[model samples]
Target: MFKSKEVEIPLRRSELISPTGIGALTTNSDGINLMPGALDMWFDNADIMENEFEIYEERLSKIFNVESFRLPPDYRAPFNKYQQAEKNLNIRIPMVRFPNWYYCSSCKTMSKEVSSRKDSILTCSHCKNNYARLIQVPLIVACEKGHLDDFPWNEWVHESLGPRCKGPLKLISTGGATLSSMKVKCTSCSGERSLRGLTTKDSEHLYDHLSKEGYYKCTGRKPWFGDRIQNEECSCIPQPILKNASNAYFSEVLNAIYLPPNRDAKIQKILDLLALPNIMENIELLKKTAPIPLIGTVLKTNFTSLSDIDNALLEDGIAKIINSEDKTENNENAVLLNLKIEEYDLLASNEKIESDFLVVQPEYDKDGNTLLHQKYGISKINLIPKLRETRVLYGFSRLNPPLPLSTNRKEIIENGKSKLFIKPQKFKWLPAYKVQGEGIYIEFDDNLLSEWESSIRNSSRVSKLNERLNNARQEGIGIKADVSPRYVMLHTLAHLFIQEIVLSCGYSSSSLKERIYVGPKENENMNGFLIYTSSGDSEGTMGGLVRLGEISSIESILEKAISKANWCSSDPVCNEIGMDFGQGRDFLNGAACHNCAYVSEISCEELNKYLDRGFVNIYDATDDFKSFFNYVETR
Candidate 1:
């Protein structure tokens, strides 16, 4: 049986829903499409079949006018100029995102350096090369508002950014629109340039180019300049978006968070990779919050209650998994277990689904404690090209047609190659998970949401630590400051990476070493890493994390990973690259050659042909593996 009830929310929700096309709503062997009726009930509570139904349809009609996206009002202006209006509204305003030029009474040359940040004084490199004390001004701002709407920006060019680069100002913003092409002269320059952003594909590039090739008025009296480039001298103006001091690394930061949770094996690995403890802890915490569906081999096939997950958590043999983490460095980095694709797919397709096909067979750990292993093996063997994947969108609303980012007809055929759109397109929406269909509207218990929120907070402690490290790199901060938080953050991130390798990559090096963790080790594995539960009842294998001397170089390992990540993330044909773990090389060089990262492109190829191979394992009696991850920070 299924039902739904209406509830008042702070605001409406929105998403990028799949259109009624080849790749709209889809169903696999897991379950059927549960969106339409399920969502209807959650949003409406009146007589579902009678007069209430009519009213519900009317409300939904109004909401779905713009591609069925619903959203709440957004007040925060976007950092970029693209984000504007409510989340549900899709509006693209024809405007420009470029730099305007401004002339200085003193410098006389068009060489002022613009500031990228909303806050900051403009400067000049040419002048700074000589008398470095020149004051600059803001002439134009790359305003990120609801898709640039209105205005015949294609007609006239060169508008001065009035006053400081603050919004809602009296600048010649797109707020005023004209039907025909209008030529507007620059207020300060009297010179007019063509406005091509409105209709041209190169608008964004031209807009950014404004800061570099600024608009200026020439004296025409005499060619007086030190630079070699022609037409480098001008006077009249407004300025372009400034070049930020940190633009060198801005691309790197933007590249890191782009792992699509649905596609991309690397990204999928990143998300699915979770340590047993992390998975267990989160599952236990969530069980206390809502009704979860579950199935058991020896038990009955029913929806999982907290008691069921509890019994599995406490009574199952989890100790063995924990104990496996207790190996010494000499024998650590060993594979605890391995499974093929058929097994992994079972767990990968479980969320938003319910079935008995993926339940684990219960087992006992080496320590004689109970544990149950849940594994999912996602593989290419299961890719059904003919079967379209249903696209599920979240947190977007606009009033305009929510067309996919396809400017050309061919792009429609190949959605894999669409126009690039920046994320957070605007900060119009924050993330909150909600089931798509109607069933028991399992609202999060107050206590449970709070706990999950805390975990998210704790999870970010690693990011904070990284930030602190970056800050420390700069010499501005005071000396002798407490660096403990930074250390804790790093340690946590290392653990997170370990979790990623094990859970996401399915590559476990748990049997490299054996030793004592925070608590006593009841059961021992061949590796020197420890198997134990802390006083806080945190049961986990503390493999090679008791000292800094182990894993002799964390930076080297991270740097190596970054190189491969860059190649895989940026390359277009990388999708065809197979996972061939052949010979393993020293992944510690400042320059970790990508060709050397793996053994071979064919997983079954000769192991010794390359490095990091499944064959010819390090199996070193030395504690090289153990020394790598023994990242411990003493308080």
Candidate 2:
């Protein structure tokens, strides 16, 4: 039995009785369970398993198979702090966050939305069956591996993966804080920000990724990349290259690294640029606590007022004999006092008070230098706007601009095929899902679960699985990702760089640029990587002989390219990468890094052993993806 963890899932009060599966699974980690002699167990019904479960096994196995990647010089090069100092640069993978559309229990089918207090209301939408059996009850009984879809690796297939009953995906947080000290922000490209900056609206991502949370649910079942936002048209910053490099005006101290010195002013400006909550209220409170007196001397009463007071006093006695009438008009230009003092008017009457104050741009960088850039260097000004525009398209704030859903977007946001964010609180998108419900789920029966446990423990498949895992893990963000090892990556990087260089000529004959995907054929000690291209009616099938056998020389050329890039790293932001994490050696050791994006000490001998997995080995492909680029720096 999968020790089902009672997750705090949000369901409509009426959603508990639905009969359909609400998504149940067995334990997530096979390695922890069935350690010694756990394989003798057999499934009571292997026939049913073959029908629904076995179809995906072969497909999943291919993802784990090993292959080497060929990277280009820049892509294969490891970036270090000193190198990055050459250019002000930072890198983080951007992902799109989108509203999850799914079938519901209340509706008895797939649904985009249902009117309810909570999300994922499992009640029958077709009949509002208050007594419908929820999908959670028997969800785990369907499969021995305890999964609903594909990706049945060890931990996912085993029954005792962790300390909880298997719960529905998305809702369950994989407990245990593992990534210590890892700082990440909203990947959403923030647009034109006002003075104040931003925090990722989707705390869920930052929170969820931090310390797996509670129980393992699914994340990123889709390694789906967003549609390439055609950079051909986009005008990002021009990366300075090697035409005639110049440092005409600026002078440097020595080999010492430079950082944007903290001018409390700049930090203040940036902070000022961000929305600091409770500011106005704090100001109002300060005003209330301040001292401002309306004294008699300051009031400056007129002599006519004293005379009128005397006359009124004398008239009091004579008023009985003679009927006396006195009139007084309220002065429009005068300051007045009233017993209910708070109501008395003071200075002006206008909606907003106009202030006559001078605005100043505090001159200077954090360092107290004679001057930094001569003038506000707007040479790169064009770059700012283009980058901002792209962020707008991706749904991030520019710099730190606010993106309140305006009146024009109300209708579209509420009732559109796509929404910019998920519900309750909207977050950044810019990234979206290309595939849906792309994850693994599982169930368990005693006999079936027993075999599943044994298969994981005593089977020789573990070693093979590890090899496949190692291949996929080369550049892994999470579990289920096919990684590349360090050595194999160098080969891939070198190949990628060269392919790109060859492609810029625009293809005359049969030779065209082909996107490569490394996979396994029916039988071969060496894994196979397939190639596809873009000039398609043939589905991009035409390309030259795009396969790697035992090619190691590819790494050497790549390393040289990386070194050149790093040497100019001070100018281009990218060159400074690879070495920042102190893993520079590992990333730079070889001509190419493995699929893991490791470049350290890569030799031909290493790339010959491991292999690649098609295009998601994007890490290796990145090796020379920069080959198409040329940087001509101007002094």
| lDDT scores of the candidates, listed in order | 0.22, 0.21
TM per candidate: 0.22, 0.19
Candidate 1: regions farther than 4 A off: 1-190, 194-310, 313-635
* lDDT (Cα, tens digit) per residue for candidate 2, span 323-428: 1122123221111111001010101011111221111122223542221112111110000000000001112111111122222233323322121222313321
Error of 2 at 157 (Å): 48
Q: Which number leads on lDDT?
A: 1
When summed lDDT is taken over every stretch of 10 residues in candidate 2, the lowest stretch is 382-391
Error of 1 at 251 (Å): 18
What does the lDDT come to for candidate 2? 0.21
Q: Who wins the TM-score comparison? A: 1
